[model samples]
Target: MSAASEKSTGLRIVTVPVPLSGRPCEASASSLGEILALFKIGCLLKVTGNQVLAPLDGTITDIDSSQLSVKLKADNGLQLWIKVSEVSLQGHGAGCFTRVKVKDRVKAAEVLFQFNPAMLKLAGALPFARVIITNGQKIERFETTKARQCLAFEDTLFTLYV
Candidate 1:
C-alpha cells in the first residue's frame, strides 16, 4: 500500500519504533528538552541502525519535500506542522548518530536512534520529545491501533503516529 494508505483511522493507533543506537530506556522520561539538558557537553549520541518505523505518522496532506517537513491532517482535524530538518538526532551512545532524512520509510517499535541516559542524567535534563499541536485543537475520541507502546496520538517518540 502507498504511504497514504497506511494512515490510521481515528479508532486505531499506530505503533512507531524507538530509533536509537542502543535499546531505549523503558522508563525514560518522555520529553525532548529533558533529553538535551542531560547532555551538558556535546553528548555521545549514537548513529547505529536503520529503524524501520517512525514515532511520528499521519496523512501527508501538505509537504515541502525539499525541506523534509510535512503538514499532516490528523484524525481530529488538527494539523501537525512538522519539519524534518528540525527533527532531533539521538546522541550519547556508542557509534555516531545516523541522521535521518525525509521520506525515509520507518516503522513503529523500530529503533529511531539512541541517546545516553548517563549523559542526560549528568546534564540534569531529560531527552524527551514532546509533540505540540500548534492548531490548539483537541481530539475527542480515538483508540490505539497497536496495544502496548502503540500510543494514542498526541505525538510521542516511539510508538507514535508519525
Candidate 2:
C-alpha cells in the first residue's frame, strides 16, 4: 500500500470542540432570516478562534466579494462549497453580527449581531473530533455531519447542526 494509505489504514475520524465564535442574542432590527436570504456581498465569512475561547480573537477573512474557488485560504479549502451565509465570532476576533453593512462604523468589542456558531455548517465548535493512533499521527476533525456540545473555557454551549 502507498505510504499515506498504509499510514491511515487504521485511522479514525474524531470530533472535538472548535469553540462557538459569536453570540448576537439581543434585540435587533434585522432578523437572521433576512441576512441569510443574501447570497452575495453579505455572504460567506471567516473566523479565527475555537469553541473553547471567545471568537473574533484573531484575524478574519471575508469571502463576500470573491467566489468560493478563488477567495479562500488553502488550509481552509475544506470549507469550500459549504454555503456560508455569514461568519461570526465572539469578543476579540473580527466578529460577526447585525452591525455589519457597507460603510457602517464599527469598533473592537462591539456587538455586531447574535450568532450561535452551533447553527452554521459549524458554528465553530463540535464535540466529535477524535484522536487516532494509526501510524503515530494526530488527527482531529470538526464534522459538518454531526453537531454536539463542545466545552469552552469553563463554559459549555450546545452547537446546532447547520
Candidate 3:
C-alpha cells in the first residue's frame, strides 16, 4: 500500500441527512482542495420537492442571499456550506425559506428551510443541491468504484480516516 494509505488510523463515517434526501443524480469523489477550487460540490442530489432538511446536527454559522445559501458547523467539527439553487436564484432568494437563524442549534434531519426547486428551474435556475466541507484537510477518504455511487438521505455517504 502507498504510504498515505499505509498509515494506521481511525475512521469517521458521516451519513447523508435530508435536503439531500433525494436520489443522488450525480456524484464525484474529490479531494477537499479540488472541491474548494471548483466552487461547486462534486455531488448533486436531484430533489423533486421543496422542503429541505438539515444534513447533520450543527450550528448555523452564517446565511446569505436571503437564506438561499448557508454555512453550518457540524457537531463533529465539519464545516458545511450548502447552496440551494443555481445562480439564477442568487440575488432573488425566491422559493427559499429560512427556518433557523445564525447560532441556532439544530438536530440532524431537522427542517432548515423550504424551497421550490421547480420554481427556480422555471426561472432558468438549475435547481439542485451542493454540499462541501469548508475546513482544512486532515481527514482522508478511501473509496474506489463506489465513490461515485448514488446516495439517499441517511445513507453512508462515504468513510473517512483521521
Model 1 segments more than 4 A misplaced = 1-53, 56-96, 132-138, 142-162
32: Cα error in model 1, Å: 6.4
Comparing 1 and 2 by TM-score, which wins?
1
- Estimate every model's Cα lDDT from 0 to 1: 0.33, 0.26, 0.59
* Order of candidate numbers by lDDT, starting with the best: 3, 1, 2
Candidate order by TM-score, decreasing, is 3, 1, 2
Model 3 global lDDT (CA atoms, 0 to 1): 0.59
Q: TM-scores for all candidates?
A: 0.32, 0.22, 0.70
The ten-residue window of minimal lDDT in model 2 covers 65-74
Q: Residues 6-113, candidate 1, lDDT per residue (tens digit)?
A: 454433343322222222222233333233333221111122222222334434455343333334444444444433222332342322233344344433333333
Across 1-162, the per-residue lDDT of candidate 2 in tens digits comes to 344753566544322223333232211222322432332112112322322222112222332311111121112112111122333333223232333333333332333233333443344432121111111112232222122332232222222111
lDDT of 2 at 32: 28
Q: Can you give the lDDT of residue 32 in candidate 3?
A: 19
Give a tens-digit lDDT track for model 3, residues 1-162: 444544544455444444454444444421212344553223455555565567778899987744377888988887778766655354334666678888999987777777777667776665466666566276555331133333334454434344
Distance from true position, residue 24, model 1, in Å?
16
Highest-TM-score candidate: 3
Evaluate residue 1 in candidate 1 and report its C-alpha lDDT on the 0 to 100 scale.
32
